[model samples]
Target: MEPTDDFYSAYDDPTGAPTSMTTMSCAIENAKHMHTLLASLLLGRKKDQLVRCDIDASGLYFTAHSKGKSLQIKTSMVSDLFETFQYFEAEATSFRICVNHILDGLGVFGTSAMASTAVTCSYSAQEGVFSMVLTDDGVLAECSIKTMVDDEHNDCSLGVFERSFEGAKVLGHMILASNALHDACSEFHELPTGAAVELVLHPTSFASSSDDAMCFRMQAHTPTSSCEMELHKDSTAIVQVQVEATIAASFQWTLLQAGLQVLPVASESFLRLNAQGFCSIQHMLLLGSHRAFVDVLLCPDAA
Candidate 1:
């Protein structure tokens, strides 16, 4: 969408003031795209706390942390997610800002405005105030949110993918549609909040049984699904499970439930298991013209 006159116009400050200072800024042409994406990442988050923001020439990254779980959401704003993205900093800059404030400034819906909101985000390089400007139907509202130093970094790495999982025994590997995995998680809601979702990997079929006794089996090769497994003592070679592998692993049903949030954006997902009973779930999502990936690592319960 083309930028409107109000959207492109620049303002020195919210109040009628004149200033010569220019700030580091970027504009998300379609605020709805950002609003929906943020909502998905921030779902189930209770506290409206500070989230780390990293802005660079590559893209914008937001990291949310609570309890012991940390989620890192990344997307390219220059070309992929944002219609127009610009960062003035030569090196990457990090700051702390409240997620609730950004969401509130977006105002995706429930507003009386007739036009979609255009958002402009700026940070004062000197004063360090993060500001958001929203324009809708010729009306503009600007907010300056205080920023804080981000001295902490969350080490949220995948943890030695090739060494750990490669040498470990491959219990089960299944590829299913995003909706299929979502339905599997939804069915477990009736049993218990923390009940484990059991996955039985067979030679030719993959069966998912919830704590509520709801069980369903999927073939290894179906028109719409695919399942594969390895039963050898030590082998990473993936082959269709044609015999009973007797491999069973359980994962926290709540984690699967949380993963369902990606269904609306994901197309297909692959589920894998390791000898240590670690399960990795990967989702392929299409974000506008770009393809994005989301992976969840779930630790299995003791047998």
Candidate 2:
């Protein structure tokens, strides 16, 4: 049957934005030709069965419903289905002439461009399904269509190739390092003595079957060679560091000995050191008498 103006009216409604009218018309004409062919193929078997056809820009979808049974046709392949239908439409032919034209078109059985480009096509006679997958120039295209006798379901699937590199390991490492540096700077306080300090954390080591912890060792070195100290952590939960400094002979010894005394220190100054080699000099104290001090080193070790 020719595509009437009513068929085109289905897409004219403003509510549904169906833009490709030319493609839709071609699909409708193809479906009509398929309907006629199917009728002739089943002529001797049943005369009461009614085959209906519908088409759009995407492709053709046809359904034959009769005697509590249905069969569907889906045109997913980019083939002569469109061209043959256009030929018949231009000829202004009857259903019989259109059916003959369709058969003649099918006789050629020209291969698709995808097929010529190393694509493989397969058909399942029992399932009445066709599939094509092509790979060329590092690009892939695939299409699948299925039609069943006495079944209302018909579907098509198409896909194109693209490159994807998600969940890469390098990205994970960068994110982890950024978070660690941010937390160290924001949460740790600065020391009174002007010495460059940073965290030197060690990887977690397994001490026992049930217990595991990290170790840290902090070191602070100043311009003068007079003062140098090291701090250590004896256990995973506590921060214990030893202070040893060498001061100039001219400076009073009392200044170098002041920080050695047992004084109440705040929690912010007392950072938890868990792993070996984990260091932070943010808590070192400066004494009034300790001038010409070499460096103050704080180192923590897992006990």
For model 1 the TM-score comes to 0.64
Residue-level lDDT of model 1, residues 161-267, one tens digit each, is: 33445667776675666764555444344545545556665454335432222122422232433443222312222212232354566655555455557766677
Which pairs clash in model 1? 203-241, 203-242, 203-243, 204-241
Candidate 1: segments with Cα more than 4 A from true spot: 1-24, 43-45, 70-78, 108-115, 151-175, 199-248, 301-303
Candidate 2 TM-score versus the reference: 0.17
lDDT of 2 by residue, 1-303 (tens): 221110011112222111222122222222223323233223124323333333333333332222222111111222344432221122211111122223222222232322223333333334433333334444444433342233223221111000011111111000112122223333122333333433333433333412233233333344552222222234422333222211111111222112111112212133222222221112222222211111111222111
Highest lDDT: which candidate? 1
Best by TM-score: 1
Error of 1 at 296 (Å): 3.1
Error of 1 at 34 (Å): 1.0
